[model samples]
Target: MSDWLSDQAGYVWLIIAALLAICELLIPGVYLTFIALGAAATGILALVFPELGAIGQFISFAAWSTVAVVVGKRWYGANPVPSADPDLNNRAARMIGQSVTVVEPISGGTGRVRVGDGEWPAEGPDLAAGDKARIVAVRGGVVVVEAVKAIEADLPDQPRDDQTQSKG
Candidate 1:
C-alpha cells in the first residue's frame, strides 16, 4: 500500500483538491476554494515532474496556496457584488416617503406616529393627533417627518354668507 501511494502521489493530491472544493461549496466564503486551487496545482506539478519528492510537493502546495489567496482577495476587492435591494434589511429606511398618521400629538420635537400596525417614535413639526405626516428620514430609531400639505380640493365646501341667505 505504501509503495502504491508513493507512486500515485499525484492522483492523491487531485482527490484532496476535489474534497476541498466540495467543502468550499458546503461552507462558502471564498476561502477553501483558494486552498483547493493550491492542491490542484500541486497535483498537476507532481504529474509533470514525476521525480519531485514529498518535500518538493509540500513546498509547491504552500507557495501556490499563498498566491491563490492573495489573487482572490484582489479580485473580490475590485469587483464587489452589488445588492439588488440596498435597504432590504433596513425596516426603518424602507419607510422613507411613506405617509403615517400622528397617533399621539407631536410636541417638543418627539412623539409617536402610526407606522403600519405599529407606532414608532417620530420627530417633526407640532402635529395634533390624527394629522397626516410624510416620513422624510430616519435618525436612529426615530422617524423624521414633515407635515403633509393639505390639498384644498379634498376640504369640504363651506357656504358663504350670501349663498346661505334665501333668495328674495
Candidate 2:
C-alpha cells in the first residue's frame, strides 16, 4: 500500500479530493469539506513537484486540511445568519407590536388573548375581555399586552337632560 501510494503520479490526490467532496454531500456537515481541500492541495503539490515523495504529499494534505478547517470555522463563526429558515424558530418574536384582544380577563398579570384567530397566554396589567390590547413583548411563547383606550359607543338617545342636571 505504501509503495503504491508513493509511486502514484499526478491527479491521484485530485481523485481523493473528489471522493471527499462527495462524502461531504452525503454526510451533510463541515468536516469533509476541509479534507477535500487538503486533498486538492496535495494534488496541486503533486502537479507542481512531480518527484515529491509520499511523505511530502501527506504533509501537504495535513497542513492544508488544518488551514481549511480553521479558516472555515472563523468565517462561519463571525457571520452566523441562520441560512436554513428565516422564520423557523421565531413565531412569537414576530408578534411584537401587533394589536390583539383580550379573550379572558387578566386579574393579576395573567390572561388569555386572541390575536389573528389564535389564542395565546398573556401577561400584563388587569385587562377585561373585549378590551383592545397591543402586544408589547414576547417571552417563551407568552405574549405581553398593554390595554389601549376604549372606543366610545355612539348613542343617539336623549341624555341631554341628565348631562345638564349633573353639570348643575
lDDT, candidates in the order shown: 0.95, 0.87
| Per-residue alpha-carbon lDDT of candidate 2 for residues 6-91, written as tens digits (9 for 90 to 100) | 65644799999999999889996778998899899889889889889888889989999999999999998998756565656687
**How do the residues 7-119 of candidate 1 rate in per-residue lDDT, one tens digit apiece?**
88899999999999999989959799999999999999998998889999999999999999999999999998899999999998999999999999999999999999999
TM-score of 1: 0.81
Q: List TM-score per model, in order.
A: 0.81, 0.70
- The candidate that wins on lDDT is 1
In model 2, the runs with Cα more than 4 Å from the true position are: 1-5, 22-31, 82-85, 116-118, 150-168
Candidate 1 at 127: error in angstroms?
1.4
